[model samples]
Target: MHAGRRFTLTEILVWTRREILVLFGLSLVPTVLYAGLGWHWLGMPWVPIALVGTATAFVVGFKNNATYSRLWEARQVWGSIVNTSRSWAVFVRDWVGSAPPTGPGFLDARQQLIYRHVAWLTALRFQLRESRAWEHMHEPANVEYARNYRIAERETILAEELAPYLTPAEAAYVLGKKNRATHLLALQSQQLKELLDHDHLNNLLHLQLVPLLVNLYEQLGRCERLKNFPYPRQFATLNLLFVRLFAGLVPFGLLPEFEKLGAHFVWLTIPFSMLVAWIFLAMEKAGETAENPFEGGPNDVPITALSRNIEIDLRELLDELTIPAALQAENNILL
Candidate 1:
């Protein structure tokens, strides 16, 4: 979602200030220490230092590559969200356009479905980002503004301690279903069909709209995968430990060259060791952050902004007078 301009050095520092500081402590101190040792006691084997440095560069590169892979994959999922949203919009406009006046409440039904679809985009975005504070984004959040709104229903499997006080339910039934999204889809489609049967809409409109419902399901499946799956914690942890171990070994490895550079070699070893460690750790953190795009990290796609955009687009499509402000930006960063 970072567009218009690349981040400034200041902005990068602002976003990653804490992480950078931690990496400096973890990686820089060791490298500088060993660089000094290499200069003073093992100057003859610059060859081996160069090789280790080369291998360190490769490790950093691998980390960068892995982080980018997670980022790109997350973007791909969001891309599908955008396209699917547009698809639903097209169906909505068409569905509403096809109906005549007072035709079995076709107009209301389509609007309900469309507005709910807009909401679906919002909830899906929030759910992915773990920003769904239920009272704020759910309970009253109308996933559907029009007749065919598809809100995600929290499927009820059983009753809780205060379940009986809330509403009427056969507790003995032992299970309940509240599929917000799928239920909306089925409800709207069924309502649309009933209206169509009454000559509320033509075949083409219904046919076109039905497919979008299925598309919504597919997108839901994808989001579920993204929300639950994460990068292997062990691999990342091991690499970090391995990097630290190599840094610790550097001092001993350079003992033979300690004569010429004397104490000055410490300065050289410190920076070298730390620089590589920072790169590795920074990238490892990047992957961890990218692994869950829903967490609202800097690297995450702006799901909140995306939800706002969907709201905007739906409002525009409806030609409503009460369009709200566009998604806010942090100077340049959009949510």
Candidate 2:
């Protein structure tokens, strides 16, 4: 997500410059038709257009609120992941130990659980980053904005990433599965079961740890629900339609009103109309950008960085000196 205090005006304008140019064209056309071409009859009264604007404002507001809710919920899911992951690390580190001294495999079991949990995070983030048909990542404006930073999932292969955290056989098994994250959790449960069977983990601690696993699954399901489902298309379509309709009608509504003030005042319609149209377009674009929080948008949850942070915390808990560094935001964008 944008880690800066707020987006600079220059950045905002640059992001919307193309649309601003289009708005200028939309505004200039009617002003030219009415003022230059003397097409006095082309101008419409402002009252009906203002009425459309009022309705469009409500729709746009509703869309923004809904989209923001989706974004906030996605962030909250990852927040649960952060908490669950730390708890999992704690349980794995403290709970799994030889009750009556075992072999070389005993300590390795604890390490494996922590590493595999990290692998699960990596896989889930990769899955979430997968492009959806409804996502705005492919849109020109989003694509352009994305160039300022890197998406870690896009830069690396899942297999290569998972390799460090899982054994060859397990990684192969996980890669073979359609839902790698779910299968990884299964593997975690299976390992915990084996630990309990081998007398490495107590029945009491095992029970508690299992609930944490359940929590992880619940959080995963929440993330998947957000990733798989999109805001209703009907509302999205109608919101855009209304915004565009109002933007197009803006100059027509303003030109005649300005002409009444003075001959020169009609020229004011071009700038005023463009300003009004740009505001509506910006609002619509903001909602659209927030619609898919996992699509690697600048305003997204920064799951890649969050996953890395979890890995760092878990590895440090393991007392590993060679742990990877935490990801820093590039260009003030963490993902």
Candidate 3:
């Protein structure tokens, strides 16, 4: 996500420059038709245009609010994942031990639980990154912007990421599954049961661990819900239609008002109309970008960085010397 205090004007202009150029070109069409061609009938009354613009504004506002809610909810889901993961680390470290004296396998058991949890995070993030039919990552602007930063899931194979945390056999098994994250959770449950069978965890400890696993699954389901579903296409399509209709009619309405100043001042309508059109387009684009928080956009949740942070935190809890450093934002974005 954007980690800076605010988006710079330069960044905003750069991101929307292409759209602005298109709007400018479109605005000039009717302005030239009205002025140079003496097509007085081409001018539209300001009242009808104002009504359309007002309606479009309200629709766009609603869409943006809904999209922001989805984005915020996705962030909260990942936040819960972070908290639950840290709790898992703490519980495994403190609660799993021999009854009287430490055994050779005691530390290994703790390490296994922690490592497996890491593998789960890796699988879930990769799963979230998998492209859905409605996602905008393949859109030309999004694809172009993606070049500015790296995305871990896109850069590497999921099996490769999971390899460090899982044994070869386990990784292979997970890779063979259709829903690797779900399968990984099942593996975690099985491991917990095995620990109980081996008397490494008592009934109370096992009960505590089970609830955490359930919370993880619930959080996973929440993430999947957001990833699988999209903002209603009907609302999105109608909002776009209204915005475009209003933008197209803007120059027609403005030309008459500006022409009242004088024939020479008629050209002023082009820039002003284009500015209004660009604003609507920018707002629509903002909502569109935020609709899918897991799509690896600059505005999306920083799941890759979050996963890495969880990895580092859990590994540090194990006091490992080779723990990787946390991810840092590049160009005011983290992914």
Candidate 4:
């Protein structure tokens, strides 16, 4: 996500430059027709335009609010995953005994459970990154802007990311599964069962650990819900149509008002109309980008960084010396 306190002017301009240009062109066309060609008939009535603007404002506001809710929910799901991950680390470290019969296998079992969880996190993030037709990541503007920062899923292969967290056989097994994250969690459950059978984990400890796995499953399901289902297309489509309609007609309405001011003042219609249209267009763009929080946009939840933080914390719990450092944001954006 954008770690900076606010977006830079250059970033805002770059994001909205295409919309601004279109708005300017739309505004200029009507001003030129009305002033230069004396096509006074080109001006639209102010009352109808005002009504349309008011309606567009309401629709855009609803769309933005819905989109924000989706973004915030996605962030909360990941937050739960972070909290559960730490809990899993502590439980495996403290509850599972490192004693007799359990022997060396006990330590290996604990490490395996944590590492498999890391693999699950890796697989889930990669799955979330997979492109959906509704997502904006494939759009030219988003793709171009993405070049400014690293996208972990795009920069590395899924197998490579999971490799460090799983053995070759386990990684291959997960890769072969349709839902790798779910499969990894199942494997974790199986491992916990084995630990219980071997007396490495008691009945009460197994009960505690199983619920955490269930919580992870629920969290994964929550993430899947957001990823699979999009903001209602009917609402999104109508919102765009309304914004376009209002923006297109704004210049027509302004031309007549500016014409009454004076001859030279007629030129002011272009900038004023462009400004109004740009606001609506920018709002539409913001909602569109926010609708899909896992698309690796700068505004998206920093899932990769969050997963790394979990990994570092879990690995350090094992007192491993080679723990990777926490992820650092580049260009004031964490991905």
lDDT head-to-head 1 vs 2, winner: 2
lDDT (0-100) at residue 199 of candidate 4?
85
**What is the lDDT for 309 in model 4?**
94
State TM-scores per candidate: 0.67, 0.97, 0.96, 0.96
In order, what lDDT does every prediction score? Answer: 0.54, 0.91, 0.89, 0.90
1-335: candidate 2 lDDT, tens digit per residue: 99989889988999999989989999888788888989999899999999999999999999999999999999999999999999999988888883432223324888888888999999999999999999988888778889999998999999999988888888889999999999999999988888899888889999999999999999999999999999999999999999999999999999889999998999999999999988999999999989999999999999989999999999999998898888998899997
Give the alpha carbon lDDT tens digit for every residue of 148-256 in model 1: 2111122222234213212132222212334334544555566578767987767887787778778778877776766666555565566566565555545444433
- lDDT comparing candidate 1 with the true structure: 0.54
| Alpha-carbon RMSD to native, per candidate | 9.5, 2.0, 2.5, 2.0
Number of the candidate with higher TM-score, 3 or 4: 4
Ranking by TM-score: 2, 4, 3, 1
Give the runs in model 1 whose Cα sits over 4 Å from its true position: 1-60, 97-107, 131-179, 250-259
**Superposed model 3: Cα runs more than 4 Å off:** 98-107
Residue 98 in model 4: lDDT: 65
Task: Give model 3's clash tally.
Answer: 0
Top-lDDT structure, candidate number: 2
Q: Cα lDDT for residue 217, model 3?
A: 94
| Of 2 and 4, the candidate ranking higher by lDDT | 2
Number of residue pairs clashing in candidate 4, backbone atoms closer than 3 angstroms, sequence gap of 3 or more or interchain:
0
